[model samples]
Target: TFCVLLAYGMLQQITGLRLQDSLGYSSSDAIKGTGALMTSSMALMACVQAIIFKFSVKNPARLLLIGALISVLGFYFLYVGSSFWIYLAGMAILGLGMGLMFPANLALLSLNSKEHNQARIASINNIGKGLGFAIGPLLGATLYQKTTDLPIIFAIGLAIITLILSLISMFPPRIKSVHKI
Candidate 1:
């Protein structure tokens, strides 16, 4: 949740600036373009979420890992992209990655929790997301002030950390079950 929001927050803050500076768009046009990009990303995310739900029943961990890696790839595209179309493509891919991972992670958390505590856990999860959203834009903006690439660099680092954690979760330590007579 944190990583997801962190990436998104940074992207949201930077998109307009990128459009104006890199694409030679007017201020109003840049805002509109950014809005369009964000809307397309959301639409793609919805579609991807539906597809993942239909196809990926077992091995959500693998899906999660794939999603994280895909997000990294998306960020890489954003970093290197010179055209507006490429930026749009990166946003779409990022949306797909977020769609794939968020549901799987939430489902996994739900499956691992007690029924009574489910609401609390969900609330906590949302709180974490909220915190990430609140903090990420500020951090990204501050880093951007220093250098345009810094926000992306920070986002990539966070994505890498998330990927590592997902990998670790995939290979959890085995537990021995005890039999009672």
Candidate 2:
């Protein structure tokens, strides 16, 4: 879970620079554009969160799976897109996924954890988020230096892995019930 968030944080941190370079924007314009992009992403995330909260209280695990899949698509868009609008759209999609996955996963964690360990779990969660914030940019920048799209590839890989793991966790193998005489 934290790994996914970390990858996302890295992508969010560096996407502006990539957009600026790719689009040939002046620094000021790039900053403004990045701001707009981030704001749009965040706004979409908030909306998704609100909608999920209102309507999807019964099935957080399902929501987490959906969010992970959506995030994979979002990363794919970022990897393949060249235009500003396309990138913006990708960011918006990523935001929606983040909104869904973040809260849903947290809720699942809280529900599953023992009461005595709740504080520890919460602490670990915050640490994961902090690490993501710290590491995402550094990792993205290093990968970007190696290849233009490698960071996006890395993010996509992370999202895919996360999605696969979520699927596995959500749908464990079940034993059939036997009828007794």
Candidate 3:
């Protein structure tokens, strides 16, 4: 998971560099600004996730779907964004989705697995992430080389994947309420 996250972070940096180069901006500009945007987005996304968790503790599927939708929109914003502020907003939105996604992914796994098997399930999830990390950079580079719009492509792909996962996560095992409302 760390590798995957690092790859994601690195991909952002690479794409930012590419964008800067293409737009005739200083190469250092994207590198310098990305960290700040990342920090701000991370904070914003954390807040968004907390709100989702507070209200939807038992509905991991719904949370995932909402996060996925927001993420998709964030990606869109990133795709067409022109200014630094626009990029920042788009990044923040993506961060919001990611914040929701991290917890929601865990929730989905937990809801799907029995308590006894949760550890194994989590391991499997981590393995999936490892695979994603291994593949994401190569894929990002390939797509970027082909499209010259790597950021947009990455954003669209993230959105599509989120939507697909959201649909899959919707069918977690139902819990029997201990006490009726």
Candidate 1 residue-wise lDDT, 62-160, digit = tens: 878988998888887788878888988888888888888888788777877899999999998899899888988888788888988888888888888
**Model 1 misplaced regions, further than 4 Å:** 177-181
Q: Give one digit per residue, the lDDT tens place, for model 3 in 39-154.
A: 76778877977787667677767877877787777767667777777777877887887787778788878877899999999998788677766776666667676766764666
Per lDDT, the best of the predicted structures is 1
Show pairs that collide, candidate 3: none
TM-score of each: 0.91, 0.89, 0.78
RMSD to truth, every model = 2.2, 3.0, 5.7
lDDT of 2 by residue, 12-128 (tens): 667777877787877888788788778877899899988877775677778889999989988888888888888889889988988888888888888878999999999998998
Give candidate 2's error at residue 26 in angstroms.
2.0
Cand. 2 Cα-lDDT: 0.83
The most accurate candidate by TM-score is 1
- Quote model 1's TM-score: 0.91
Error of 2 at 82 (Å): 1.5
